[model samples]
Target chain A: MTAVMETAGLGKQYGKRWALHDCSLAIPEGKVVGLVGPNGAGKTTLLQLAAGLLTPTAGTIEVLGGHPGSGPEQLGRVGFVAQDTPAYSRMSVSQHLRMGALLNSHWDDELAFRRIEALDIDPRQRAGSLSGGQRAQLALTLAIAKRPEVLLLDEPVASLDPLARREFLQVLMEVVAEHGVSVVLSSHLVADLERVCDYLVVLVASHIQVADDVAELLATHHRISGPRRDSRSLPADQHVIEESHTDRQTTLLIRTEQPILDPAWTTRPVTLEDIVLAYMGQARDQERARKSGLGVLR
Target chain B: MMRFAWLQFRNQAAVVFGGLAVVAVILAITGPHLVHLYDTTVATCAAHGNCSTATSVFLKNDHTLQILFDALVVVVPGIIGVFWGAPLVARELESGTFRLVWTQSVTRTRWIVLKLGVVGLASIVAAGLLGLMVTWWSSPMDRANASMYTAFDQRDLVPLGYAAFAFVLGVLCGVLIRRTLPAMGTTLVAFVATRLLVNHFVLPKLIAPTQRSFALNGVTVQGFGQMNGGPFTLFPANPNIPNAWFYSTQFVDRAGHPLSTQVLTSACPLLESGPGPSAPAGGGVESAVPAPGAGSALHDCIAKLAATYHEVVAFQPASRYWSFQWCELAIYLGVAVVLAGTCIWWVRRRLS
Candidate 1:
């Protein structure tokens, strides 16, 4: 019952800048994890580190109980769909399948062929000529054929149209149901994460703002409104992830393990999108404070 | 892995066939014609009153044409190397197809190693086959000519070695540059420049003397005076002239080889039984016929000249052909290994 992927204080750096900073999370087996973030939130960097495509700059990452890049065997167990669905343009659908068969120890050629056929891609048509959706589908087909224990998808459906996007997510769910493979998909679209993911981790400004089971998160996090007051007065366990004030009224999205017992404040459930927007605003406010050399948001 | 390599080879068959055909045709057609011309002209000129003029001109032209053709071998393979090697990985990276292969269970190291192994071996084979054709076609011309130190002969190990070097260099450049046009350009410039430098400078010093010296008119003799000097000069100006000479330095022996300056001088004393018996009486005239001290000069001269002689100076020795072939192959293959190792390191640590 080892965690499928575990990162201990992980950080990724390119030159002087950090792509992902102090990210510590454990994604257990058999769960679909959604890595949610705004632009440049280090989502792709985190996925790449988990998939062993990149080495962590500051800390360790383990995949299936060992170092991320242990060897081909570990790589075979962890399939990755890199951002933008980078398919070989000159190769035909059949060629990709051949490459999969050659490179993977657990290749499911029959499944790949069937999937490509179902997608209406001509086996002979070059990937270069395929539509964006078709290319993304083809890339997914290759990843699924490997039958990996863990799948790391970085913006897998970012390029597809709305209709294609829905179909791609549906296909992923069907595969997950049949194979029980652990998945970690990074995306900017909250709606996509909302429909398919059961586990969620929100990243903003290179920080992990929230990590929890989606059901538990939806069940507990609430928006509370009451008379204006300093945020420091809130209970220590009631963490306010984002707060806004307007002339004697204070609105806050607080993550709490216990039920709300106070009668003075009004509490309402918040959607994932609202939660993401709140985190983004908090990040922007912190950036402004740091630039002005003032501890305004303490 | 072999299948992938074969696929690459099949795709590039057109270039391989085209290059080989051009090399063959040029060698066959021009080779025999040059041989016939050399035989007829040198004999006619030797019979006529100017053997020196006939031989010198023939050798010069022979040297020029041979060097030019040998250079073609490098050019043809070079074109193939630049185009083939530069595009091998760049095309994959540029088109985003590399991710498909990279994500598979096979490590990046295996992918690059297999590609380089198969293609590199193919290059050596192609170069070896072309070398054989060139050797066969030019046998007659090589036998008749004597520009041992000229570019043609000096260029013997060149075509094969440079082709392999250029191909591997192209692969490395492609990986490092990660773009087609610039990789091809850099590889071509680097390969050609390195080759020219090696042939013209480093290699000559490795096995052959750099500045070869020989007296023109046999200066300083034992018994004979200047009149008996009989003026001797190098027929082809050593054939292996310095690469930078504007014209052959004709060492004008205007002083009719004086006896003290030329009568069996130490410059090129006749190979004989101990220093011409201290110059015989009666003008000390040594007959051209082979006698003890009489024959000793020519015999010893021939013996001394034997070591510098070559059976086939224009091409490498048959015995050492495979040795040179394998050595060049190893150099490029070794380079391919190093490049692949770098690629693995990048994939493992920095690829994202």
Candidate 2:
């Protein structure tokens, strides 16, 4: 199957500064892709570009085989939940669904109505009157009602409480399972993405730090703790990313293909959270180095 | 789109109906009563030879109404522009509802075009209906007293055209400015400026008299009572001149020079002024001057002489009522189209 979404050297510039830069990514069809980055990591910009809310200043972006800004048909295929959970305050929950029906060719009113009713949201309650969680749920309902081929959600559960977040992700997972629609969700919460996403893309300091299958990535990435040594001493296949050393010991987050053979080193499998933090640390260091023109990476 | 616009209209029906009903009631009650009272007074004066007093008071009332009509048109449309049109786009922008509409299967251009078209039609209809009603209500008075028909003077067509102009300008400002209060302010400023432009500059040029007539015949002319005469201005069909057909003097033969004066009179002295003997040959300069009031002895002699070789030359030009209407309408319509076009262009190019 064709890649449902693809970006090649896609960068967005706000004046002289880059919001997202040098991003190249491709996610194949039928996979739940998670975009993990810290705040202002250009995650939202990337998602907005993919969703056609913004134009990329450099390079190319495609959503579901067509260009990102292909307009209504491409837009109809892609459903975006912006960070604000934007909705018409005057419209009722049912009216929002009605608006979705009017705007989308493949509107699934039954699914929307069912989800709203199950959530116990009164059809007549105005969107402005809804609680934060309820409004998030309503926004999700509107996004899902379109039955879009590619759903691009930017931090859908960012503001929700733990319970609401879990429930929200659970419903998303259920919907994707039933429809097999490709979803690209951006979030800083790696644990949630680990539970629900099949694929992962880590963006750090305006660059793609990593992109791989979540399960595969977790399997290969290992944290090796040992006595201090120069990174040049490691084998060529081992990519040591975030290295911290005490006088006695060195703990390195490394991506390696082979199991550790050193007797002095203790190696353990890394969690998704651990991998994400490693990337985050690398991003901060890179940003600091770029700002100050210091060579911290050898 | 029409359905949606109608929905908007229905939602604000209370405001629309309430305002219209109140104004209508005031017009219905006060308009006819004032008109009738003026008519009765005119009739009473006509029977009692006290036409001057009744004419003055009734004409003043009519003038007041003329100014009121102009003011009324501006205020109503300004209200609609500020309240309805400013919020038309601002409310959506403020609530972020336009994103929902904009991101849909429909094109943004189509969405805006539909909305503007519907609202524009509604605005025009409302203005047209109101204009028709006012025109009907004031018809009897307009006929009875032509001077009271100050529609041309006050730029009445501008207000009708301005309602739409104001509405469109408000919506455009709303979308471009993206803030409700600022948009309302801009709309008010724009409407007021255009109205003032029409009233002060364009209307005057359109209706201002260009040629003045220089004679008054078969009438009791009054109130140029203190003309030692250098250059006196005359109003054609002067209200102060009763049954007096008035005209203006382009030039007069005075002091052996063709000096110019717009002064209306019973006569002009028919000879040259020179340093000659008291009865200089062929200098037939009269020592006599006409009495000031109507039906005086000297006034009769001058009227007879003026009748013999009557030549009424214009000192100022003449202008028509509809000329003012058309010119003012053209100006206002031009503004409307430019504004509407700007609105369309901005929405298409910069709206997002």
Stretches of candidate 2 exceeding 4 Å from the true structure: A258-264, A294-298, B1-9, B21-70, B152-157, B202-210, B216-320, B323-327
Instruction: Output the lDDT of residue B153, model 1.
Output: 28
- lDDT tens digits by residue: candidate 2, B239-352: 332222223432233232332332233243321211211211122233223333322432453364443332234322223455556676677667767877787777665652
Best by TM-score: 2
Docking quality of model 2: it rates as acceptable
Candidate 1 per-residue C-alpha lDDT over B137-234 given as tens digits, one digit per residue, 9 for 90 to 100 = 55545544443333342244545555566667777777778788898999899877876685566543333322233343222122222225544422
What is the interface root-mean-square deviation of candidate 2?
2.7
User: Which consecutive 10 residues in model 1 chain A have the weakest lDDT in total?
Assistant: A289-298
Model 1 alpha-carbon drift over 4 Å, by segment: A294-298, B17-71, B148-157, B208-352
